[model samples]
Target: MHLESVVCFFAILSLGSIATADPNPNQTGSGKQLYRNRHVARQQLLSTTTRSVPPTQPHVTPAPTFTPTTTGSSTPLAPAAYTLSNGEAAIAIIGATYAAGIGGAVLMIGGTAHPLAAGMIARITGGGPNGDTPEVEIEDSNPVTTTSSSASSSSSAEPTPIPSPYIILFSPNATAQEIQSVNSTLVNHAAPNSLSEVVSHGTGLVVFFKAGINPNQADAIRQAPGVGGVFLDETLGVDQLPSSEQAPLSFASRRSIDTDTPGSPKASVRNPADIKLQSDAVNSLKVISQPAGAKLTELPGYGYAEEAGKGVTIYVIDTGVNAINPEWSSMPGHKDILYAPGAAKTKKDFLNHGSCVASKAGGPVYGTAKNADMVVVKVPRHLHTSAVFTAILEVSNDIFKKKLKGKAVINMSLGHLIPDELHSAYEQLLDSLTAMDVVIVTASGNDAEKGVNDVTHYPALLGPTTDIIVVGAVDNAGYRAPFSQGSGIQLNVSAPGYVDCANGKAHPDTQGRWGTSFAAPAVAGVIAVWLSQDEYKAKLQVEGQVAARVKKMVQDLAYSRVEGQPPVIWNGIDPRGLSCASDHPTGFIKVFEKDGVASGYYDVSSNSTTGGVTENIEQWCLAKCTGPCVSVFLYRIRQSASDGYYICNQYNQPWTNNLVQTGVAAADSGVVFTKSLNRRYCNSPGKTVSRAS
Candidate 1:
């Protein structure tokens, strides 16, 4: 530590070769008085270093210390000044001369000082208070002032500098009185009226500070009793410039290619023997088979009539749904399709976008969740960032007013710039929607030719929030659609956008409907299927829990065209893991581990509508453990008591790497199931289980 110096000048009297002097009254009011003031100031500054300022009454206390020395009559004798290299050197120099009453007299220059310097003085002694010393302000060769007790006082060590116009997140438990105290503190120290836009959501409040306050104010705010955390209100915008690009496919009837074709590069129809039919209206249209003879169909749910979506509400936030159309009005739940007042109350599809999207969501014949109802939210033709934000807020509030809190899914096919400037606000809104049990689904965009990244869109690239799911379009041939935009980490899954529909026909069709716009609704419709089930409906009761589970179930069960590519969602709503028989028990679970080795995975099975998981699976690994295992997965699964097979599984596998090295159990645990809900079964649920050597 460098020495902090406090000095004074005195007049010298020469009676011989040697010189002696008395304190000059002009320089300081009586040397003894200056000494006492300096002593108090030094004590106060050091004592207050670890103390906090009172929020209600913010004030600075003064401490000062003074000293005097003998000098020649015409000239004052300068005190000995030594510049040490660092604080430690200054301490050593002062410690060596402690007997001379010059303890702590080494002037620390923040940096190191050299004794070999020409103008440096080595040692000198004078009378003064000896405890923690005051920081003496030296200006124009005279000692100006010597006391400092405020929190804003500058020192050799840097403090947490307060950034102006920053946001403070108050603790969840902060009271109104504590909030008032914080306001008083800011007013007294930073500025008279430094705060703006104080908004509260749930238990948290977001407030802004004025610009150009003392940079050290952040430290004070952090130390304040009521504040939880503080962050700078940064402005971030989309890196890619916004463009008026068109979607990959325009509105038209579905592609009507005959099952038999010759010399057509894209045509690859299934054989007659493999084609499965449910009714005349719903037929299993297989386009591609991966392992050569393996059959895949568009309408995969053939006989599962009980899985029709029931009591699920799909919000189509798109270019207005036209209710007057015969295709829409004739649907079972058509009366339930409500519209936002600003989006116009009439049933009019101005762009033919919302109609196609709504059909894909729940249009009875063409929809994924056959029985789910629809709520149309129309966005403006030419979108603005502010308007879209306002639309989200307005729609959220509308949902709240409508009392559609849980089991409500939002399907947005519109695309907008995710400017870097609005990342915080956008994130805050999405998080709020999630906490309220509302799930938002948005398209990954259709700008693959333009080389646009998936996250370039606002809601789609809103990062990894459990409540938002981003979808990309895939063609009938089980390949990623050439025009579908691919994302970095946020894209959840892909779905069929190329549905076969007849032109000028009464039936709803997805044939000509392409782009991520149509793809998003397909996934939304699939989520509606999950919501319809009593098992998933119970899970949806907990806000922000089901979206992650849905994504996981799809990831575990869905087939992909190529490895590492996003897997496409199941062709039909009733997949083996999403539906169940009466005897197939389902439950929720929380897994735990021992030193990254396997421990216990507890399963809480729900017996009634109240909801719970009652069983657990305990796994024990034989040594080879080295790291820690995180508590991942919140699941709802269907297991057959006799066969020990996981029939319908819905769980969240956190997208993080937990395994440190290779082992038999180190593979994706998501695909694994157990016998008797314990380690002995060694079975895989979604995929085939194999033994390790």
Candidate 2:
């Protein structure tokens, strides 16, 4: 028993030496001794059982020294490693074993167990196959706060695009099915509520894209069936320039010659004996009738047809018209003023431009065709291409529905520069309207100051076409206005641009407005007057013979004023014949005379019995009358005939016989001598007339 005890004691001493042994003999003794002292303290505090095991080198390299951070600094502390005594290392293994056993119990108790505990056990136990030491990585636990600079840098990765509007025009021959298909494609690719039909006559549409369109999407649309062209929808402005004050008298004061003032002469006096003196104002109205170099005193007042545009309608496609103004209110009925679809409901002229335009066309005091009807088609202040297209379509449809084809005239005092494709679309729409015998008159745009040629402006650009009559501006002296755009070839006619027009304020107030906007309306009024005549109306009703004749007549009768300017528009009256007593009487008067010798009378039945012959009665009288002719009468012997026959008599003296005595004799003899049928002419109020029987 004594010998066994001595061997066991030796073994115990050997095991103690191994537990306290230092594996790295080359390592600094101070670090090893400090680590062992800390392990001993930790082992006493844990109070866990320990087992002997051989020490191994750590798998990871030794980390740098850890430096604690201050409160103001956010730098994380570096991870560190330390050597442990054999006994303390054994105690760590035993604690890890206990944790593994508890984790197994948790797994058996509940199915929702975390894998973190198992993962820790695997990391602690699973070293290299060659028996290398395991490592425990300690990541910095401080929460990180993001900076604004980094956030901004991350946010600026992508960019957004802007939207734009475009117009899609279909081919003229494109079928309705094809148009529908193209529209469907646009709706699929375009932004919501962005597609709209602009002009049904030209088959055009407008669409907007909020997110902007890519090249691929545009190409797809272009490749669609029946798509003629796509163009950017551009905005336009009114054609009027800035207003100026240049009138000598107000509209009310200029309306009549103040008879109360007698010799004071508030206004110029028109020749009472000379018929066709419509207005007393010797301003723009007088100049239209006089020749280029005539003195202001020699100028006659405005001369127009007897019908005075009675059957014609002037469509003023502009801003809007104030129907309540005296210029329009004085007419028989206020019902002549009309608004196009999509135009504003308000009758007030916001810009006061359309009212002035309307006044120059057919106002009671300052107009050309004093009795013509006016239709106001309103547009936005800043005109859009789509809005213009829609307006034109509305006008065309209205005229066709009301059967006011040739009797209608559209006066467009607005224009803008447009693209080629858009120009084509306009041409298509206008061509259609003109085919129906609707005359279109437009202003030569007021873009001369901008160096823009009148031919470059739309509607005016289409002036070269026979159906459209484009007028440029000329001052009162018959010289082209400084701002008037166009060469003589580009413009169809010229008219007084500077004129005393309605100010669109209160009733009877006037302003001296200047621009081609005023000139075009005057020409429109003249066309209205010409159309009111029976001969032109008959020509309009004939198939294939449209407004071309009317357009030619206007151009042919226009007289040359300034050398470089277009011929100024005339009211189709010869100033030389104003005081004449030819067969073409000036006013609405009739005369019938029977010579005592029957051989002196010339029968005109073989020439022309149509009512149209009355327009050229002077020429017929000159050709058919044999001897010295004093008076000519148009008579239809047959009561059933639709037109009258001309009878030129050589009676040079006036006869004083009552019409009732002639009618009673004609009824008893079975011969009907109707009242003399001469072309009716307009006369001023309270004019004396002398009829022969």
Candidate 3:
């Protein structure tokens, strides 16, 4: 069927079913109007069929300066993804009521106002609800109308408009040496169809480098100095059109972020050689004993936990997995969920990476929840902007359609270190999930050293609409892994995942599996455990409580205070050991759960220090430097009424990581801190926070 025809069919169907719905002042005319932008983009693509896939190598060109396209439909000019995916509001203005040649359909912009979007627009353009909005009685439940112009196209044959290229940042800690090194490498290796540009933000610098030449050349650029890392730097056979590009998503671990897969792993234990592992919760367990503990059969005193992963379902939006292992031999259902034109993955999927992740969350091997159901997607480990963005949307569509979609938690172990087109799509997807109260978890990328502490993996950088759960790694001694991304202001909390993926003293698994990639699921598992609790039955409640408590617990309980370290603001470097802002800066947090928390941690890099990655951001922000921690994820903290802990409120602190900051009407007063900062004393109601000098 033609794209227009399909849309018309859906529109008519919708209108017929809603004949009795209330008339909306927010929506003019019938709600069945077709979208003009979708039609325009599709027409553009169809007319310029050659433009569907972008060139392998692309040169950065100035944005085309052209007259705005004439509007064809008076209907909404807004796109569906933003309105449809986000559930906060269902009303919006698609196109201006008075614009010339506007399309006829009236599209409800479809969702609640985006806080960051609102702030950014206000900061940049100065357009927003002003003095006229406050005194007016506004109902929070009423839908809102928004108006925007549609992208231009040459003709009506093409149906979809292209997206403009953009970049988002997590945090950047590149020193002069590192930044210089990265810059030199890219400039020197500049080749065909390649483009590089750096845009610094409050968090870090976004060095956007496009693909050129071949895979080998791309690999070389990926290794450029100052350059932290690169993925598909060029178009994946797709165009650089505006509509085609989207930013990668961010996810937080604070929302009762569960790493929990189906259920804790289980075994029969009929023989005398099995490893004695016990289940603590679904898709979660601990290795109680390992002797001449043959992993294949049962030990004399060991018993197996026969189980199912209960009602929870967890998703892994990475590669596919081996679903037929003995561990999953009895699983009721396991399916592959990836599709491309003439390409679809089947039950016999490929998931070498997925297997490792599953071992920690869902299991055919060992996991937090043995019975937790799983949804596996076979996205490429590395992909071009178009492919990655498309993959993100496709996965979200699947999530919307699945029976287990609402309650399941999703863990994304794969990511790009830099923000790209996929970011926006991922953000919308997470917002969709958040509104439904689905748990989302992601690993902060593995690039922590070489002063790359600030940049994070995809989905890990998304905003609060996700109610996401973000995680970093911790060492066996209960301190943050030097390489583990910190929650300073952009993330949530930590978990005991190490380079080797070990569980306890004397026994380890997956040796050398270091990276935040290996650490995230531990937090996921913890979220799963929390979800099983009575108070956290609702996914939204689980995320909020767990995220809040996580920050509190970690700040108060984790790690021992190291003495005599250089203070963040030592009045003078050696202003000869002059008084400093902090006599002892509490730089680390520890994790503690009820007994039998089904915990696992590895012992490597014992000499590693916590907070290097995040502390860098705190320092940058404190300096009132351009870069500030955009959001804070309070992963864990000590329970209220616990001893010796002073109440800390969330306020905008400036550089030097000191509580004393300037410019805010009241940086020290009450305000909801940005979700990215993960502040325990956030803009949320809490006492002001300060560190001892």
Candidate 4:
């Protein structure tokens, strides 16, 4: 291998060139000082080069050495000239030598040196006593400083001299309409020449300009229509930019990392044969396969050992869990946090929406990951502007203020971008949970036509400390779900969630299952399982631990970035790269790199609840708050075991006290005992009793 340059600049002076002349004081002082300073520069440059690379490499390569020739100098450089160290100049010369490959280094040209370049040299080796050597030395020695402008002009003549674009952040609250306004405003303000590209983050948007766009511009937009707030893009900086890969901690700041590595108690990735649907509507539902812990002999768990989401309390801090399943009631520690009273205090499905979610989420013994416990908290929603964010913050308050033991994993299947007092509260709660080390998972959203602009949803935008796992919807072919909200900007990872929103003449899968909203719970369940496993424990944090695990598992299972793409690690996206002007920012999730050469999927959606409300009511009567009639559940059924609502079925299925039916009882209503709990259409529980009607 070739040896690296010994000194950035080696003066090969010929000894024979020296001229014998009488002593000139002015010449002696300047010439003598310059010679000594040059010598010091020589030594330091030699040292830096030698230590830079490995010593094992051969150094047989020929190197030009420095030599000084005697000359009668005009003005002598003062003693201060010796202050500049060789290290300062060497870096400059190297920079000038290789401008294309590396950046950030300043090139100080001589015979033609740029002032800024000179300034950089001076800064590198400065005035302080502690400083290795003063920049005064190099400053005094360079005679051609005046011509620096010309040299820089010459060097810059070549293409690609401009610095890379700065990273800019966008607002999530920005809607398509707002984005246009902001883009126009930015164009009008300074660079009226060109338009700024808007990066859409679905519910939220991020915009980055070729030129710098300060926080003020962001603030200005905040006051504009549909704008939320603006903040600096803090995703990149010098430390995070990459200095020394192995350097001992770059900054003193403390950040959290997911402690749940593979060896830990956490688990990842689980599949099931089928989720047991409700008894009444058997027409459309079918158990293609049983979920984990359902038929253990058939489905089985993913880990080396069986792991269930036992201790981890999963709180769905959005529309509360409608929870009608005998399986939904089976979970222990399941509770509701409806702070808004009659509204958020709902146990009944609001429009039957909550039930559809709980069905797939906390569900029939088969749906709940063998490892997780579920909690459904209803957060009020303003359809035009999703206001459920406060529900999450309220849940966080319970975790932080109450110091709620066994913090729950929050699953928010709903999202909206409206800023108000709710946001302030939301931030407070997320900050606390992130600090407490709780994980929050949210859907990437399901609002894209032909899938182009995918903006990020929040609480998904929580701090780095909080492991806010943003999931996107993916189809069985590993392609991004058309309805699934996407964009590389905010999604952490994707999951299989493509059924179909509503049957459309265009898309037959409509109403079938195709949205990231559904995909989020699966991830929530998997996270719960990982948390329950003895191996994960308190190891993984939401950020470093859980996010990392998900990334690894996705890649390990051969998950590519996109359908026809390569696998990308859990690397954060360049928020600046997003184009708000385009659609489906998160839609780029094709399958970067797959488990096999190609493959895999995710699901989440927004609909007016799927399983139908009436049936859910009957299921509730027979399972959760149902009285003595609870004895006939397919999974497990029994009356309250403790002071709370709970039941145990013949199959040993465990259920909790949830969603008590308003009216109707077994003995009074005559809900026959032939099959345990049965429903009737009469006025009171005592009026009509029908096992088979």
Residues 1-693 of candidate 2 have per-residue lDDT tens digits of 000111111000001122222342212132222222111000000100111111221222232221121111232221211211111212222112211111111211011222212111111222323343222211111212221121131232122122245666666555666665555444433443455554332223221111123332344455556666666555532233443434333332332221111111112322223234442444677666654344545544455555557678898877677766756664431235444433457777656667788888887667777767778777654445555665676677667656786788888886643443454556666776777778889887565666655444456656664468888877665667666787755688888877777776655466677778888898898888778777555645564346677777777667655444457787654343343244334432344434221222333332344323545444333333222323433333333335334433323333223322343221221111222334323222211112212
Residue 411, candidate 2: how far off, in angstroms? Answer: 0.9
Q: What are the TM-scores, per candidate, against the unseen true structure?
A: 0.43, 0.55, 0.37, 0.37
Model 4 TM-score on a 0 to 1 scale: 0.37
Q: Could you tell me the lDDT of residue 390 within candidate 3?
A: 41
Index of the highest-TM-score prediction: 2
In candidate 3, how many Å is residue 562 off?
10
Report RMSD (Å) for each prediction in the order shown: 27.6, 34.0, 28.9, 26.7
Each candidate structure's count of clashing pairs: 41, 0, 152, 121
Candidate 3, residue 653: Cα displacement in angstroms equals 66
Q: Give the least accurate 10-residue stretch of model 2, judged by summed lDDT.
A: 39-48
Return the top candidate by lDDT: 2
Candidate 2, residue 574: how far the Cα is off, in Å: 4.3
**Candidates by lDDT, descending order:** 2, 1, 4, 3
Which of 1 and 2 is the better model by TM-score? 2
Q: Write the per-residue lDDT of candidate 4 for residues 93-203, one digit (tens) a residue.
A: 211121111111223433333322211112223322433322222221122221123223333332222222222223333355555544544433222222233222212
- 10 residues in a row with least lDDT, candidate 4: 39-48
Which residue pairs clash in candidate 2? none
